[model samples]
Target: MNNQRRTVLKSGSGAALLGMLAAAGIITPGMALADWNKAAFDAKSMADTLKALGAGSPADSKDVQVTGPDIAENGAVVPVGVASSLPNISMVAILIEKNPNALAATFVLPEGTEANVQTRVKMGQTSNIYALVKSDGKFFMATKEIKVTLGGCGG
Candidate 1:
């Protein structure tokens, strides 16, 4: 099998094993999941989400970059990218202002690693996307508005 297929199989099997364990109570549901910012992910508003993320007052930064299509053809799956030229970026998060959950994703960067990440997220409607970056123990962010269309057919 190709490397990509092998990796997929390995991950799939791991998830299956974890599911079995959780079902059998050998592992609790929480034990089967990775550590994450639950509060941030569950926050409904931008202010609350940033508070949960420990970025209560993030400064706007030109070094931070948020890249995505101005119009996402499909609201079910919108591609987003976040990067930063600032130094010591220890964390990166993508936030959607109008989504049920403001914070969509977060990545913790190891020391010396570049602050660049990309992911796809669901958008219920048009919203502002923010790329929040933690650099040198300070929080910074950039934002862009993305219009979400219903299948690009104007439903």
Candidate 2:
């Protein structure tokens, strides 16, 4: 009787452990989709890209600030910064006008956290860089033109 009780308890504990692991995403049998759309990135213009990415029409928001050099010596890596003063910032996406794929990067911001992000992106040539901000269920944006002296995409 004692042996049977111990075996049952051990089996129950093992099942519980497996449940916890699955909840924590330690195991997944199939591929995972993370909201990536190739068609959207292939957009020809910034406006088209924004629409395809579901960003809607982003308004010019003074509360959002973008920092970057006015000119870049190398187009391969252009540093960009975005900081939002507004509340409930949900996301930040970087876009380059001249790149084959305009959407460079996208970041999801958690609640009650500071909305600031920085990253380097490749540029095909001298083009406009835009920072798209999502706050309060709306999209806001800021843009700057970065002149690239040396072609990074291909000379």
Candidate 3:
């Protein structure tokens, strides 16, 4: 039994060491970094956010879906989700129309990843939420409205 335990420990340590090496850039290069657009996230308007994201006036699409509560009791952490049935989806972004910053969140999907995400966002008041989906270098959107009784952004 002691010998079997030693063998298992050795195998686990070997796998861990390999993972550490890969993370340290010894096994693979340029695999740890992700593309992030800072300007889009900092934008305060829908148009600016689109421009920063290179979406260029997305069209409305039924293929995309936005899901969330119709009414939120607290504005501080309203749950939101975006999902797409469209093929080859590369990105998903969540935007709140009435927030100080329109663009709330952006997610970049790696190849072969399913185009779906859920997150909590702060909403100052009742507003329309937009889920922007990008597929094959083009953009599409879906919208939903959520009412907030208590202000989340310092009400």
Candidate 4:
């Protein structure tokens, strides 16, 4: 009985040590770092979302191309593509004006990587889509209006 108790205590101590190591950063965490804040994104207006994402005083960029259908037959899957011709592009953020949440997606563009991204998002109504790019520590932005023929959320 004494031997069994000793073995249990050893096991518990080992588990505690491993947990400590993980917490101290000596061991890798189980999940990847997800630094995204959902609550801030959920209710932000377009301009506020831009500020929250650290894109201060973004200028209009003609080099940033936002390609999407002028009108979407279905609002459920409105395809959008964004590409940038600027150098040192770090990030690309997508925002929809008419959604309850303005910010839809944010992509991290690594250095020496192609500054382009494609994604589909649900739109409740006809709205403007904005592409925000972070280049050389400064922010540049572009916008395109997309019309929805039929409402995806509800007509």
What's model 2's lDDT at 104?
87
lDDT of 2 by residue, 1-155 (tens): 24433443487686676556547655332323223555567687888989987888889989988888899998888899999898899988899988887888888888866899889888888998898999888999999899999867886
Give the least accurate 10-residue stretch of model 3, judged by summed lDDT: 27-36
Scored by lDDT, model 3 comes in at 0.86
Local error of candidate 4 at residue 144 (angstroms): 0.6
What TM-score does each of the candidates earn?
A: 0.75, 0.75, 0.75, 0.75
The per-model lDDT (C-alpha) reads: 0.83, 0.81, 0.86, 0.82
Candidate 3 — which pairs collide? none
Report the lDDT tens digits of candidate 3 across residue range 6-93. 4434876866775676576444433332234556777888899889889999999999999999999999999999999998899899
| TM-score, cand. 3 vs. native | 0.75
lDDT of 4 by residue, 1-155 (tens): 24433443487686677567557654444433224545348555886787778776799999999989999999999999999999999989898988888988989887777998999988889999999999889999999999998777765
- Minimum summed lDDT over a 10-residue window in model 1 is located at 27-36
Which residue pairs come into collision in candidate 2? Answer: none
Using lDDT as the measure, the top candidate is: 3
Give the candidate order by descending lDDT.
3, 1, 4, 2
Question: Candidate 3 — which residues are off by over 4 angstroms?
Answer: 1-36
Q: How many residue pairs clash in each candidate?
A: 0, 0, 0, 0
Candidate 1 C-alpha lDDT tens digits along 1-155: 24433443488677677567557655544432334556678899999999999999899999999999999979878899999999888999999998878898889999877788889888888889999999989999999999987632233
